[model samples]
Target chain A: MDNVSQEDYLTAIYRNLDEAGEIKPNLLASKLEISNAAVTDMLRKLSRDGFVDYQKYKGIKLTGEGELYAKNMLRRHRIWEVFLHQTLGMPWDKVHDEAEKLEHSSSDEIINLLEEFLEYPEVDPHGYPIPDKNGKIKKSKTVVAITELNENDTAKVIRVNDDVKNLLSYVTKIGISLGKEIIVKDKLEYDGSVLMMIDRKEVNISNKIASNIFVEKIK
Target chain B: MDNVSQEDYLTAIYRNLDEAGEIKPNLLASKLEISNAAVTDMLRKLSRDGFVDYQKYKGIKLTGEGELYAKNMLRRHRIWEVFLHQTLGMPWDKVHDEAEKLEHSSSDEIINLLEEFLEYPEVDPHGYPIPDKNGKIKKSKTVVAITELNENDTAKVIRVNDDVKNLLSYVTKIGISLGKEIIVKDKLEYDGSVLMMIDRKEVNISNKIASNIFVEKIK
Candidate 1:
């Protein structure tokens, strides 16, 4: 429909569902940084537009049509993000904000050209799978939190759980990225800090930070 | 001022001046693909805003202040272009359009972050020098046209003179890119086609196409 506002709501719902396995109004409000009332208002609008199934107070989820719409937006967003960070040489943290604006503005002609230019990258800078043109995502659920790894377990960083600006700059400064191998050396119970080896250097990270790091074991 | 529109005009003027060494209204109109009247209108606006110097029936050029603004815009644009193509896997031709939009929208904070993320790229996807954050360009100006090359002369493809959509795809299919080494092997005087070697493969390119390729001799 090219209704940007509606698409944003649908995409937000998709992200919320992906994270929570169910869309909670309060969580939606938090994620979008909008008021709970605003979320409710939008949910009603989305339900009326046939993009969501909303039951007041209980929660909401995307309809089949809504999921399709949301998935497309997500696909565009991630693909653009990959284009920005990988091809454009943008920092991982900076790409999200720029892509947030661009994903909504891209035309099919440009997106198709970009897809070919990037050789149809399957994943974004954060290692999130970029859905194919038809909205088919390569099925994958392999995500390991850094905090759970045993000593000397080697893994490649995959994706981060959040897009908070401060956190992104913090992690990036330490030189960790997708496909960057890290070995867990020790986990301190006292402060939830973990010692890990990254790029041949020992680095200590907090449990809160470790939990946010999604990784895959090195083969 | 971080106005996107102003930044676009400044960047456009800078690019035009760099290539031609002088900016003519008609030339700018052609480069921007706008009408002469539109160019005149914008020139007036830019002059009034202190980004250009215009004189009746004469040429246009960036003043010291305007040069600073234009170079700043260029720095942002080229840096972002590098980020898009290199890190995100975006195709070379596809990145310019996106970078055009983003170079203006980014804040200094984000641009600096991107520069660091990309490890401070020297040239963009198009092989144009990316002005440093302080606005100094690592200078190189050795222009060689495809039409002038003789057999056995080797040069690196620097950039194309145009960004037309069909032309970009066509050139890309022939495997030309900035920094790609090409060697002229034969020139057909009849049809003005040049047979060249790219890496190991032989390619015959039409004269019409060759005229647009901007290259530099391999040192």
Candidate 2:
């Protein structure tokens, strides 16, 4: 994308789309932390530019062209994250924000070079699948959020939502990482937080945080 | 440094400084390809911010603080150029423009990490020295422009001016590069051009182009 903000908006829309492949303007505003009016203004611009299908007070959907553009942005972002984490030895928790700025700044040529240099990694540091050069995303396993796991259920941590600020650092502080085994110990009805056994130590995470963490069931 | 244009202006001024360590506003404007009035306005802001010493109708010089900041920016630029050229296999001629955008988007930590990843590279692809973290530049041997080489003088290319647009690509096309040895065969007094033998082939370069190519006299 030519403009940083426009690239960001498309990526956000692509990331937050619901099962029907659409997102409401209000949800987008909240995700971007921008005002609803600003979202409306940008939606009009995107519509004019043939990026999104928009109608007054309707859910926003990306046009085919917009989808390709957004997938390319994600490709750039994830490739940079891999390079930052694996090549530069940057913390995985820190790669997201760094990659965000770099995604908009880098060209496709640079990203392609990075992808090859990193040996065509399957996923980013945060465990999100990286879309290929043609915007073809690899199929990933179906996973459930930690909050959905029942007591005594065992699952392996697969992905953490990088969109939530400080979530990865907090997850790291609790001794949780990708591929870590965790067993649900208890579910609090009052606060909606989960108590899970991580590396034999009990760690309590709020339901909001747990819901943002995806895991594959083991038992 | 937070703003891209401010960082660019500082780097441009720092690179184009003459022996007196000062530059005329007009030259800076021409180098940046911006208007004279815009340069004046930004100079005022930079002066007020203590980055540069500025007064109406006088040459401009970097303050100690400005020099440090500019050196850091150059460090970032050079490190990125090395990574793009050496690590990613990007052509040396193309690294300058790519590094220009990446430099402003990167953090100090990222640059330091890159420096380490590249194993403390001393010079960029263009043979420009990379400033250390403390803003200490390594002392370089005295060199002169290719135009300064007398007829029959053999010299080794040390540096090429990366500041000039499309200069590196042109140099590459003409079979010139850092460390390439050239022997001056003739000098034209008419237009001040030089005829030199490069790689067993005679190449004639204009005085304008020759002046931008720095070399160390070997014999």
Candidate 3:
């Protein structure tokens, strides 16, 4: 659909699936803060517009065209986030809100120029893959649970899926970033607290926090 | 009015007054591609909103609040233009349309971040001054007409008011840019043509072309 609302719905669907694999109408409705009927109405419209494949109550999947459009928006969002952080020195936690507003308004010219200006960045400040102009995403091969790490095993932090602003700021304050490595030294099962050496400094992280951290294990 | 249309009208008025001292409703109508009556309707709404002062049968002027908002938009527009050019490597002539779309979409945070990213740039890609974030514009001190130059006069190219893409690209292709200095060797007044020395090489410029070039006088 040519309407902005339709585009927003498509983008929301893409984002939800990107973060959570599959999407439910109730989940989409809650995320958009709209009624389930509204989501159903738009889903039908999207399906009719050939942007989505819908199986009645089976939820929604993006058609090829829809997926490309969604990925474009995602690329724009992540690029802006990187610009905000790298160029403007914005804190990573605060760039997402700005990116959210900028992504929808960018034209293709700006997007292309940004790609060139930033030197065709593969990931955003938060370590999320930035799709290429043709909607081709570079798959990130790193996935490790902090809880599974043995002593002396090392991995670099990749991304944290949580949206808590305080948590992001806290992580940054602790000197950990997307490419920084941490070696697990000890794990206490009773308290679920893990001790690790990060940047050659000892630190303690709780189990709840450990699960939120995703890393790429060192070869 | 709390409408985007009112914002556009106010911005247009401010831009016109900035370039020229006063703005007429017909000019606004022509620029916006809307009817005079529609502009009148919106002008009344803007007056009611305290953003403009209107008089019947005469053009409207911005009130303080209106001018403030307009200047903010102008600042954002120019700053985004710089980002698209310096950081993104966009051609100078191609930045305006993208900046126009982005200016309205940017938040204060994003604009400020961009300003810092570009190290608080003073001028846009097209050599126009970018108003500071607080809407304080840097006044240009030098103005020279290229057509008025005599033989042996050295001058620096400064600002070009016109934004026609073909002309800009053509001028840029000739290795002429803002602040490039040239010494006039001969002025053939018969054809309004001039032979100028640039970078130790002589170049002939047509009268029509020479008249459009604005420069700064050398000491």
Alpha-carbon lDDT, every model: 0.79, 0.94, 0.80
The order by descending DockQ is 2, 3, 1
Q: Candidate 1 chain B — worst ten consecutive residues by lDDT sum?
A: B160-169
When summed lDDT is taken over every stretch of 10 residues in candidate 3 chain A, the lowest stretch is A160-169
Tell me how candidate 3 scores on lDDT.
0.80
| Residue B61 in candidate 3, Cα distance off native in Å | 0.8
Q: Residue-wise lDDT of candidate 3 within B88-151, one digit each (tens)?
A: 7778767777777677767887888778867899888767787776778899866766888889
lDDT of 2 by residue, A1-219 (tens): 489888989999999999999999999999999999999999999999999999998899999999999999999999999999998899999999999999988999999999998999999987899999999999999999998999999999999999889999999999989999999999999999999999999999999999999999995
For model 1, state the Cα shift of residue A50 in Å: 12
lDDT of 1 by residue, A129-190 (tens): 88777778897768889988888898988888545556777898897877788999999989
Q: What does candidate 2's lDDT look like per residue over B1-219, in tens digits?
A: 599888998999999899999999999999999999999999999999999999999999999999999999999999999999999999998999988899999999999999998999999999899999999999887999998999999999999988888999999999999999999999999999999999999999999999999999995
Select the stronger candidate by TM-score from 1 and 3.
Answer: 3
| Residue range with the least summed lDDT across 10 consecutive positions in model 2 chain B | B1-10
State the DockQ of every prediction. Answer: 0.09, 0.90, 0.57
- Per-residue lDDT of B108 in model 1: 68
Pairs in clash, predicted candidate 2:
none
Q: Which stretches of candidate 2 lie over 4 Å from their true place?
A: none
